[model samples]
Target: MSTPASRPVTAPATALSGPGSPRPYQSYVYAYPHKTAYRPLEDRPALRALWAREPKDALSLYLHIPFCEVRCGFCNLFTRIGAPDELTGRYLDALDRQAVAVREALGDGTPVRFAAAAFGGGTPTFLTAAELERLCDIAEKRMGADLTAVPLSVETSPATATADRLAVLAERGTTRVSIGVQSFVDAEARAAVRPQRRADVEAALGRIREAGIPVLNIDLIYGIDGQTERTWLSSLDAALGWEPEELYLYPLYVRPLTGLGRLGAAGDAAWDEQRLRLYRAGRDHLLARGYEQVSMRMFRRRGAPPSASDDHACQTDGMIGLGCGARSYTSALHYSFDYAVDMGQIRRIIDDFTTTEDFSRAEVGRRVDEDEARRRHLLQSLLQAEGMDVAGYRERFGVVPAGHFSAELERFAARGWLDTAAAPGRLRLSPEGLAHSDALGPELFSPAVRAAMASYELK
Candidate 1:
């Protein structure tokens, strides 16, 4: 990540000095304008108008399934523990309703097309084989996304990666299947409250490989209690045995309302140091083993087939998300059904989503304006190893990032995190900057978004 020299600073900002420097690990900024920043839309904007002027070609489609067999200790996702036999059907029935409404909203105008699609949730595979087939039908028949043509990715768990469920996904043209194997060590699994034996995880992975899906993704987590470098590598090598096409190495966070949070598990500077050390180890291990780093948490095998479905950046393009836990994005607004982590509140939201007859309007959301949009563009682009394109910023916003984010860039340069020799028209992060992406991402949050996210109630 060599870059141009001497970052310039003409604006004032928070200090990122050597002494008492910010912790490398902050909140993960996977999405700009985090859901916590969203609120109930009193006006209830119609989905029709939301997409009327927005670009529709090459859109990304997502469907959320909020039911999971078991909730992990560190999980704070909007998902319930299990669905009653009747609940799954009710959920799909509701999904079909939402899809039909959304398709109608797209209005067969401006050549609407979905370039990629994903099934995510508590675990999309929580549904039975027949239910999964129905889920795909809802996306293709009702929502008008051609699953067979697009790169379709689905999330599954060790318990739910059953052969029958996987067969449905394969038949429906699933190109990628990601299973969260946080750790292959039984002890670490127990500490994470993700109850499963090594035997079961191995069996599940076998089924995934046997299913003949093109790309397989394994998700591993660092920073579990009682984890050490040796055991971390043990888990890493265990995952390597499957030669997964993609791997996500996540840093565990004991967020509020999660099992670890309830048990008072907290992060300290020492813990941060441990996670950083482990992250570097894991990263280097994968890189040496013929895996290329996509981001801090994602790595792909060197010759893996391109998975464009995962590349639909909502920061610029539009995305359509269905189901209670899913979210959608347009150029000016990001909307979702509701946001929650508490089990009781989550269940309430799921129940509400299942019985609703109308799905024509946005329930809760936040509108993105020009300035916030600029920040998002810079933040997301800079977080990548390739960095942002200077020309693209000017074309979109009529200004260069170095000038708009001068103070932030200067701070990063001072810390040696911003590349000083990147080619002209390119803004990239130094290796260290990508390593501390969690912290760097948060620093770019606009004051209003930061305040809103701060004030949001977890429940």
Candidate 2:
């Protein structure tokens, strides 16, 4: 859920990092125009006007729950560590009000249909079973997303994945439930400041399996301070024992203001090499066990039930994000509430969101012109192992990816990163290319985005 390193700075395309650059593990571009690129709008655009001309069919709906029981060491997502019951209740109430306003904004002029939904954050399962039911209600009755009909995914942590909460999710047709285990070795978990034991993690997995959710996704992190190839494999094997349908292997990134950062532990050349080694080990082990690589961090067991999320690729579809920590995306713009990682600032923003009566207009955002739109499309697609289709790019933009990104593509080819085999019809990363995706993603960032992200105050 957090970016690699969670750093405020970005790599400028002119100085693109390559194999010799100590391996740029400093960024992860899951979505284009990171929230850091956003600025307070001079004139808040009405949501109604924003969606009027955009395609609404196959929209992706996201809800953010910005509360966690505890914060891990390498964390900088837009969530508070702990929130009181009254605060959570207030947050849900605010969510209901916002959902109504957003749904109304997506009028009948365009057919507004959501193909997939996700609840992410500190942890959606942090809410009580009853509260979870209410969350689903807001999505269904207020936002008009048929959660049951659409593929819905929710994120959880080991401590909060209780049977009751899993039951609520299952009943609501949550097709996938991802649990953040971080590590199976108890000492490693503590080293990462995740504060969970192997036994507890096992119990949580058992509960999720019992809940009968179609897809169980286990998330693990490599590159913790003391993590080794042996310990990393131990964690990977432990998670695989559950035969989870999906696995997300993250490289731990300690950024400023996070627990690890405060402790003065930093990523160096050796650490970068260690993470790269462990990543390759984990990737190979999973591939050997019959899992297919979906991206740098994601792997799916072959023939596993597909997430409804697959119906809407985040790169192209319009998305409705309904929380202070979430972001709404359109072809022309990307917007969200103010973002901050400091505890004091996060609570302040959450408080502001809870009391917000006017959800009709966007407060902060970045306008995406044709140049940015094209960059977003290629960056999102080429990072994948499947790569971008030449026809698809041409059909949408009236130009080929090569026509616009010749220099960048040639540089990648020089590094043996781009696969010549796929060139005429498609653009895919070679195995080595996929390994360095974190570096490659930022190389595509527009100069303007780099400047904005560089200036944003992480705190």
Question: Model 2 residue 170 lDDT?
Answer: 98
Question: How much is 220 displaced in model 1, in angstroms?
Answer: 0.4
- Per-prediction TM-score to the true structure, in the order listed: 0.95, 0.96
Our model 2 lands, by Cα RMSD against the true structure, at 2.2
Give residue 125's lDDT in candidate 1 (0 to 100): 94
Candidate 2's residue-wise lDDT over 18-102, tens digit each? 4445265868778788878999998999999999998899998888898899998888887887787599999999999999999
Please report, in order, the local distance difference test score of every candidate based on alpha carbons.
0.85, 0.86
Q: Report how far residue 352 has shifted in candidate 2, in Å.
A: 0.8
How far in Å is the alpha carbon of 395 misplaced in model 1?
0.9
* Regions of candidate 2 where Cα sits further than 4 Å from its true position: 1-22
lDDT of 1 by residue, 183-234 (tens): 9999999999999999999999999999999999999999999999999999
Q: Cα miss at 188, model 2 (Å)?
A: 0.8
